[model samples]
Target: MTTNAAMQGKAMSVEEEKIQGGVQSLEVGLTVLDALTAHNAPMMLKELSEVLSMHPAKVHRYVVSLIRKGYAQQLTDGRYSLGERAHAFGVNALKRTDMLELSQRYIQDIQQHLNCSIHVSKWFADGAVVVQSLESNHVFNIITRVGSRMPLLKSATGRLHACFQPEHIIRPLLEKEWESSAKPEQYPANWEDFLELKAKILSQGYASVTGDMMAGINAISIPVFNFTQQLDHVITCIGTEDQLPEGQMQQAIDYVLGVQRQIDALFHPAAAI
Candidate 1:
């Protein structure tokens, strides 16, 4: 015979299972919203249904629920688009977006994989400034700190900025750097040489230095662009020549480029979709 206590325990277990699995209706409704968001324009019921691979009637039901919640809306022509509430949500999210915070996990991943120190730099009023640094497990002392300013022509991080940023923005800094450089002969001798160097860096999609910034230290830097395709940040990996040799340069570049693509996708989700 079934006991009353056993029945109640069974009911509780089913309830817990439902909680763990989440509300299916809510999930479906959010999927509808995602379809609209990714579409980035008003979509008809038939179009959205096709995109989600669901029946039109079922898609309309979820769309109705989203409309009631102000996450979506219907136009006079019966096309559906993101609502005012959804726009506000996206605006708020953009306001809170921080490049340094977004790159932290990727930075840690690369440091662990390459066993090399990583530096993240952002352009300040003067030039590229190190905003974040992560040290590898190896016992070498990395001289770059959080507030250190990286040179425009002398460091890999700086060259990356020069490659992507507007010529007007970087030209003054480049001239000043050339004038102030202790070893002027080591850099491009004239404006034509500077242009050629920039062209080469752009062609390769990254900049690199060996025993240039600091004797014994080699570094590679890649640029990260925002949704509007502006230079957002520069990520640099540093190590001794032995740690990152010429033979292994391509491997390190691949790792950094992978992270760069991820960050780019995050900034430009519509393009990614």
Candidate 2:
């Protein structure tokens, strides 16, 4: 009995090292915050613990701490939700960030010069792409905004990221999302088609499609790379068929790619994307 107890105590001691405190607490806190941000509704203690695979006791402690610190609040149903402090922090972070500042200027320039709608997005995770900024000058409008997320398999930006991604990373990510969406409704048909499209998007420096988002509303996209040559962001321009004929699409692409280069320079001086 004594030997078993000692072994159990040693195992727990090792596990406690993984509890995430000291400087790591910030990351743990961010992890919780991120999960909350992704969810549309407030989460119960059990839901949060399940989502993070954290112990309820530990999660409760964090939730209570965040509540006391004004970053979270408890609902009448006892679920934890983001408080005003979270929104204020996010707003201030965006206000001070260079990405949006640079993205906005470039997007506006593209709109003024090309007279089109521009979408700027980043790869937030393996299976979702989030639009961080958008600009439209003509009568038509782009139906995306800051914090809007799109699925990996269906969205143009998502497809670009998938095509540019290294095979090892792309394959696993594809498989993971596929597993999650294997059921009815959202399940993708013809895996072979997806593979073929990804190959084409890779070969073409930019991807262009018409009627993907809406009929007559064509879209073109170019993946921007950071200084390290990693696909860091994407810039997409949208226009109607009447506004951009097939013959003029190449020129439009060149113009947009140039804008992308300028924005890339502004955000990452030495980077291309």
Candidate 3:
């Protein structure tokens, strides 16, 4: 006689095994969809079967089901490609992706690799506001925080924004900073000086500052643009002079720019090409 507890245990074991082993048909369907996306063009039945290493009849059955569900379409030439439904699904997913949320993992990866503080900033009505930050274990007493508004001319992140953002949008902020700055002499002395600084930052495709925002601190910043090709955010890495000396600056810059490329590729895939 099986006890009630023993029967319950047997049922639980079966349920656990079922959960571990997912539906294989769904996995195969997703693989077919992924292949279509990778090919990025219409494919004949034979081509898809060859790519997926599956029997033509089986692939055809899946393709037919996908067509019925609107996940794929058969072209007039009998080749298959992603359908309107798939496109709509992708667009909807992108619409819900927040830049800061999407970038959190990348930011943490860089921080761990470089063992320095990293932050991301977005342009607000007033200036570039730090929206996210990751601190390094080795660094302490860093001043920048989530709400910190970086100085346009005194910080690497600010300088990058000044260089990439529209002139009309940033000019007023620049003037305001200049007027309110206690040590105006530390910034560009004249319009020509400011232009030279801007040109240099644009030419280099990034911005760097040494002991500008704080004594003995160094930083490098890169820009991330959205699908519309507008400056969406800036990522900056901060470290003490000893940790990011001239010898190691190039490596830090590479790590920072690598994250920028990843983000740009995600949002602006065409520009990457």
Candidate 4:
């Protein structure tokens, strides 16, 4: 890890919420944000509290803080709304993605050496997946257009980390994902199969598809970890079988793993910071 990254990544934690003395301020804030994001509009304190199952008094404290911090604001009617600060934080957080930027160098190297398409991904709140970045030898391709929100069960990139990453690491998220909007048919199989795939992916620590999601697209994906090296995002190499020749598939996997190690180095606190 670099000296600067160590200082920045210090802010990263596995708690999944803002640290507090048994009080999850971040969770409460997200609950409110979730309601707003779901409704696609501002919501009153009563509506937000009802949706979040939190008391109005407590919700008001959070709403007030959010307003002060600029993450949220009050409307003319006194309802809560996402403030411009929320978008600013998003854009700022995005700017810190040395991982995505660094990964592209590796992506280009892999594509040129392996002669295929390669990409990186980061998990979004739900349904949609962010491509983060992508590189390809082919002038035009169908795999993971940049900024595209990939379906959880539909894309190889989605399944790569979604299923393969450990439940201790992936569960709260997968559950939160389903809770947000679950239509089992999205995976194109029975519920039982989804469970089975979860097991298969976890056991294998990776997922590959000869033909799934979009037809004629072949992709192999491996999960990437955060500072503690827990599975969080994924790095995938995509290519048509026609473009892949002989042992190139295995080579691509080996290459991606190597790149993952390099990417991982940047996240480790000791070296990164």
| Candidates ranked by TM-score | 3, 1, 2, 4
Q: Give candidate 4's error at residue 115 in angstroms.
A: 2.7
- Which 10 consecutive positions of candidate 4 have the poorest summed lDDT? 13-22
Off by over 4 Å in 4: 1-97, 164-188, 245-248, 265-273
Q: How well is each residue in 1-273 modelled by candidate 4, as lDDT tens digits?
A: 469777666656534345444556687777777677677678999988888898999888888888898888888988788888886875677456655555567667766876666667776554336565555657655456778766566566777656644556555555555566545545525445567887887675566666565556677777766544555567666777676533456766666667666776766636644
Q: How high is each candidate's TM-score?
A: 0.72, 0.50, 0.74, 0.49
> Top TM-score: which candidate number?
3
Candidate 4 local Cα displacement, residue 272, angstroms = 14
Instruction: Compose the digit string of candidate 2's lDDT tens values, residues 70-153.
Output: 889999989989988997987686446556445667667776777766677777646445565455555656667667765456
Model 3 C-alpha lDDT per residue in residues 121-218, reported as the tens digit of each score: 98888788998877888747354789999899899998888777687887788888788878867756455677899998888779998888788999
- Give the poorly placed runs of model 2, Cα more than 4 Å off: 1-104, 166-192, 261-273
| C-alpha lDDT of all candidate models, in order | 0.85, 0.72, 0.84, 0.67
lDDT of 2 at 105: 72
Screening candidate 4 with a backbone cut-off below 3 angstroms (N, C-alpha, C), the clashing residue pairs are: 1-271, 1-272, 2-271, 2-272, 2-273, 3-273, 6-272, 6-273, 129-149, 129-150
Q: Write the per-residue lDDT of candidate 1 for residues 1-273, one digit (tens) a residue.
A: 889999999999999998899988888888889999999789999999999999999999998888888999999999999998898899788657786678778878878888888899988887889988888777774658999988877789888877766778888878887787788677665567879989999887889988888888889998877646778888899999887776788989888888777887888877766
Superposed by TM-score, candidate 3 places the C-alpha of residue 100 at a distance from the truth, in angstroms, of: 2.3
Off by over 4 Å in 3: 1-35, 49-71, 74-77, 190-192, 267-273
The list of candidate 1 runs beyond 4 A from truth reads: 1-79, 83-85, 270-273
